[model samples]
Target: MPPQRATLLQVAQRAGVSRSTASFVLTGRHKDMRISEDARQRVLRAAQELDYRPNLMARSLRTKVTKTVALVSDTIASEAYAGRVIQGSLAAAVAHGHLLFIGETEGDPVVEEKLISDFLDRQVDGFLYASMFTRNIRLPKLLHGQKVVLLNCLTRGAHPAVVPDELTAGLDAARTLLDAGHRAGIYLVGHTRDQVFASRERLAGIKEGLGDAGVRLAGTIDCNWWPDSAYDAVCRALDDGLTPQALICLNDRVALGAYQALREAGLRIPDDVSVISFDDSDLAAWLRPQLTSIALPHYELGWRAIETLLGQPGEPAVQRLPMPVRRRASIGRPPAE
Candidate 1:
């Protein structure tokens, strides 16, 4: 037979206190009750000595609310960005004495729906949906009554959301390049006319920063957010006699690929063609000369998402958070002509 578990009554007996007093101390209610320090110590000592542990399930059932909240993400295993979001959310939840239930959907809405449905059946107290990439997302109707938070994306209606402020990112990047004495030939490598929220806002900030110095866009290229795609676009532009002294890639991966392409074309980073990009991914710092990139406030976004869910979800409004640019070895003054 298994050993018998210690009970609160046993702790009270050992501490020479009433069951109510023991309950107050063990449940951390002694502070509110103004219990004497000595008495509180006695209760704590007794609890530790007897190894008394309360049944969380019973406590939750009595309160009629599960202390668990579900965090749904598009793809958590992709890299540290998603993992960092989960880490931040869990840290906040744990501090609040709540349990976290994580769900990964791999960018599939069907998987997300199933996870939400299953969590609902289990009486989760709230929900958090973190998008892999920022975009407008339509939430499930079943989440109408439950507290929900959006991380990295926003809904159509008023909902609690936390996302990276791409406008700030752009400004930071431009400032970094300007500080390096780069006044002209700053090319922005980005998506086509269907600019996403991040891309559009970042571009606007970059332009605004350049405009402060009466500088204009040197050039622009529409490339898929992939290295090879950006490489091809840059190559074509170079062939067409577009002389870009600096390349601002939309992402680190694209910047890295552009580096390779430039090398093949007898160009060198910072020596011939400088480079910078958004998203300070691991690959950014690992490049040959290292890549200067924007730092998104990913952890803060995750923390805020969980905090908002703990409160009440309200009208969907966009909340812009500030981001900074990380200067690395990839950016420098234009080649001396």
Candidate 2:
């Protein structure tokens, strides 16, 4: 037979006090209830001896606050690159004495709706809608009038959000190259469009950074975010004798293609040609001469989302976290003529 659980009645009897007095002491309401300190200590000791555990569900029913939040995301739960977002959210939720329930929708509206409905039914205190990438999102109707925070994504409405400052990241990347003394032969390896927020902001930042240095971009290649397209673009540039002193790639994948093209042209990294880029993925460090890049701050984004939903101080309606540079072997002083 299984061992029976200890009850508050048993604890109160063992402590030589009424059940109400024992309850007041256990719940830290002894002072409000005017219970003596010695009585409170006796109740605590009795609870310890009896190994008593409170019924959280009953407590929550009386308090009317479940102390739980739901994290709803599209692809973030499965994607390795965005896993830190979940880790950060979990840490922040636990720190606040709350529990976090995670759900992935895989970009399906039906799935998202069902998940939101289920969470609402469970009496979750708040919702965190996250995304694997930075883009505009359509929040579900179920989240209306409820505490909700967007993570790594934004909406047209006044919902609070936490995302990376792509513009600043671009500017920083350009400054990193310029700081290495590359002036006239700096080339951008990707182009930006209207729909993609990061690309547009990052490109603007790069232009601003270069303008600050009193210099201009020598050239740009439209690679459409594909490594093969970047490789082809770099090959064509080399064939046309466009030997740039430095290359600012769109992402680590684009940089990989540039690396291959550079090797084919017999150019050594940071010696004959320097390289820098963004999205400091594992591939950045995996390259032969490690690629210097900017991190997306995925974990901080998630942490800030929870903080915003929890009504924590210093959380803005729209929070843009800084993207720090990861220094590596791919960047150095440009070769002298």
Which candidate gets the maximum lDDT versus the true structure?
A: 2
Task: For candidate 1, list the clashing residue pairs, or say none.
Answer: 157-316, 158-315, 158-316, 159-315, 159-316
Error of 2 at 85 (Å): 0.8
Overall lDDT per candidate, in order of appearance: 0.83, 0.90
Per-candidate RMSD, Å: 2.6, 1.8
Q: lDDT for model 2, on a 0 to 1 scale?
A: 0.90
lDDT of 1 at 84: 75
The TM-scores, one per candidate, come to: 0.90, 0.94
**Which lDDT value does model 2 have at 203?**
90
- Per-residue lDDT value at 171 in model 1: 79
Model 2, residue 141: distance off in Å is 0.8
**Reference-based TM-score, model 1:** 0.90
Residue 186 of model 2 has an lDDT of 92
